[model samples]
Target chain A: MKTTELESYLAERRQLVQEALARNLPPPDTYPPVVHQAMHYSLFAGGKRLRPILVLAAGEAVGSQPEPLLPAACAVEFIHTYSLIHDDLPAMDNDDYRRGRPTCHKVYGEAIALLAGDALLTLAFEVLSRIPATIPPERILRATRELAASAGSQGLIGGQVVDMEAEGQPVTLEKVNYIHNHKTGSLIRACLRLGGILGGAGEEQLALLTRYGEALGLAFQITDDILDITGDFSQTGKQGGVDAARGKATYPACLGVEASRQKAGELCAEAGALARALGPAAEPLELLAGFVLRRQG
Target chain B: MKTTELESYLAERRQLVQEALARNLPPPDTYPPVVHQAMHYSLFAGGKRLRPILVLAAGEAVGSQPEPLLPAACAVEFIHTYSLIHDDLPAMDNDDYRRGRPTCHKVYGEAIALLAGDALLTLAFEVLSRIPATIPPERILRATRELAASAGSQGLIGGQVVDMEAEGQPVTLEKVNYIHNHKTGSLIRACLRLGGILGGAGEEQLALLTRYGEALGLAFQITDDILDITGDFSQTGKQGGVDAARGKATYPACLGVEASRQKAGELCAEAGALARALGPAAEPLELLAGFVLRRQG
Candidate 1:
């Protein structure tokens, strides 16, 4: 596919997921509008919607239309949005901005901001539990289990715990990879695996999609690490070099910029190969892996 | 059920639930022990185990042993523990103590406390999703939906959001009711509803149990509100009159103390009626409602 075509594909899916998310969210006019508003403020804050897009793309790759996958797609985005909100709290990364907008805690006070994150995390499960009856019940159960496990201590939170503990310590490749693979990689991989599960992929297809997802996630994180060092401040939407200031472990920090870039390239190539193995239906996944490689922010 | 027998029954069930929670929790020795330790500290703190015991009693009332409901029982306690942790954050209630010990944030700092809460919330759904294959998948899915809804924006968190927003504002009975019914009542109701659900309750039984649960929760909260003003600090395990000092809206704040006590009595009576309607099978629930009415703390 042409670069412009792939870009259009991403844009279209992004819009679709955003619309679904808006529809799925509790309306802001609901009682206690502050929490809803805070949740809305962070969720609609110009996220790339990459995780939900991957969920849709992976489902499509497995011969399912994106419509049936909307709940799962939105569910992943809710989890991702909640993580970002909590990560930006004063006690966490202490960031003031995300996605070119003030962070949730920046706009809402810390108390509401904390509840906003809690609300979103619970809402993820609520969204998943309400998946339409048209999908096989078993599939919905399986997807729900996968999504919850991915977000729990053994996955996203565990990775976060390790990452937080590792900060200011001497950066080690093994430790950084553990942090990266768990923190960022688990959810990304779960997004793909969920898509495959919902699409009713066979065992071989599920394995391929998981492999593709793991590589894609690693590539995505390495790219993020590189951009934190090299991207324009406006483009990155936060102060550059903040990671270094905080002594945060990063791919470029441990391995140097040159090797980090090479690692991202190799992972992207590996992801592409896995996508290719799935044939023509995986064009979006293949192109998205490339997009991760080429993204500047 | 005799009062002595009921006391022994409550004690035995509470112990069972505690053991189950200990077994279900991820060990503190897991990597990044601080988060797990924080989670463990807050969870094992001396909660009355009322919710889990209710789950067991409700299941027994519906003719199922509590064994099959262990996961659901533990899941609710995890959620309850997480809520308390977040509620005690400096930005929230800012309470230094809970259940006679330092709050999670007080002991573990705000960041880890926040993540510990998040981890527990996520783990609740994880536990529910893994309910043993002995339970019908459909029933598990239905219970999962109920549990998620109870904890999400429209239920527990929604109630909390409004409660927090109402602090120091002029108290109104309607608003306080919304906060109490939603925040505390929702989960309490869920515990009984889940019990019926796991026990293969028919529609009528589920409805009756839900009604009983709603009344029990209201009575429980009213008793708690009254105790905040009238009970001994040593008995309540926290400062008395803290609610009034914080200007937190409570039943006694909106209703005069005499009326609030009367209301609790009425609700307890109403709950007993519902339990009685469920026949001798619901004796534990009936006696428990009476226990709530007679408790001093």
Candidate 2:
């Protein structure tokens, strides 16, 4: 797919995800409106909806329609958004901005922001369990397990813990890989696997998607680290050099910008090749791999 | 059942839940050990395993064996523990101690405590989804949904939000009841409902359990409030009068100690009557309600 075609595909998918999210989430004005409002404030704060899009794309690659997969798609986004909200807490990354706006804790007080994050995380499972009755209960259960495992201590939170602990410490490739794989890669990998599981992919297809996900997730995080140093606030929606300021570990810090970019390129190529093995239905996954490599933010 | 029999039943059920929790959770020595340690630290701190016991007793009320319901039992306690960890965070309640020891955040710092709470919450869903194959997938799915909904925005978190906002403000009986029903009542209600759903209870049995849960939850919280004001730290396991120190709303604050005691007694009586309606298998639940009313802690 050409860049423009891929952009349009992403835009269309993003809109579908936005609609599903809006539908599934309680309105901002819902009772005890502050937390709901806080939830919406960050949720609608210009996210790329990358995780949900991956869910839809991977499902399509497994020969399933996007409509039936919308709940799983929204569910992944909810988990992603909650992670961001909590990560931005003063006790965590202490960021004032996310996606070019004030962070959730900055907009809503820390207490509400904390509860909002908790609510969103809980809501993800609620949304998954309620995935349209068209999907078998067994599949939904598997999807829920996949999502929980990836987001739990051994996955996303595990990575965050290691990254937080590794700050200002010695940087090593092994440590960086562990941090990146757990923090960002785990959920990203789970998105594809969740899609495949829910879409009824065979074991071989699921394994192929897992390989594609691992490569894509690592590539995506490497680019993220590189962008943290080289990209401006306008492009990244975050302050440039903040990681360096904190003496935080990153790919650019560990491997240099040029090496990091090359590494990301290789991973993306590998991901694209793996996606191709899933047949023509996975064409968009191949394109998405390229997009993740090239994205400025 | 006699009080001694109920004590034995409670002890036996608590043992089952503790064993399941120890078996299911990643050990403290697991990779990225601090967070796992923080999780274990708070989880093993002595407290009455009220929620998990409710799960087992409610399941037994409907003729299901405790062995099959261990996962669901442990899952509720995990949720309860995660809530305590987060609620003790500096950003939230900022407590220095819980169950007689320093809080998780005090021990592990704010960041790991936050992540540990997140990990535990995620692990709850993981445990639920992985409920033994003996329980049908559909029932497991339903149990997952019930747990999430009770813990999510409209239930547990909603109450927390409202309670946080209502702090140091004018107290009203209506608002206090709302907080109790939500913050404590919702999960307690979910515990019974989860047991009924998992145990294949008929509609009438489930309704009785729900009603029993509602009364027991409110009664338990009311007793908790009275204990906070009148009991010593040895029994309650924290600083006494801390609720008044924070100017938090409570049943005793709203209704006065005498009225609050009367109200709790009424609720327990109602709960006991509902459990009695569930037939001989519900004898334990009936006894448990009286225990809630009479316990000092």
Per-prediction DockQ comes to: 0.73, 0.87
lDDT of 2 at B182: 92
Considering just chain B, what TM-score does every model have?
A: 0.98, 0.99
Residue-level lDDT for A88 in candidate 1: 88
Off by over 4 Å in 1: none
Per-residue error (Å), model 2, residue A243: 1.1
Calculate each model's fnat, 2 decimals. 0.65, 0.83
Clashing pairs in 1: none
Q: Count backbone clashes in candidate 1.
A: 0
What lDDT tens digits, residue by residue, belong to model 2 across residues B151-216? 998899999999998999999999999999999999999999999999989999999999999999
What is the per-residue lDDT of model 1 for residues A1-297, given as tens digits with 9 covering 90 to 100?
A: 778889999989988898899999989977778899999999988778999999999999999999889989999999999999898898888889887788898899888888889999998888887777778878888888888888888789888888888889999999988888889999999999999999989999999999999999988998898898898877778778878888998999999999999999999999999999998999999988889998867
All candidates: TM-score of chain A: 0.98, 0.99
CA lDDT, every model vs. true structure: 0.90, 0.93
Residue pairs that clash (backbone atoms under 3 angstroms), model 2: none
List, residue by residue over A257-286, the lDDT tens digit for candidate 2. 999999999999999999999999999999
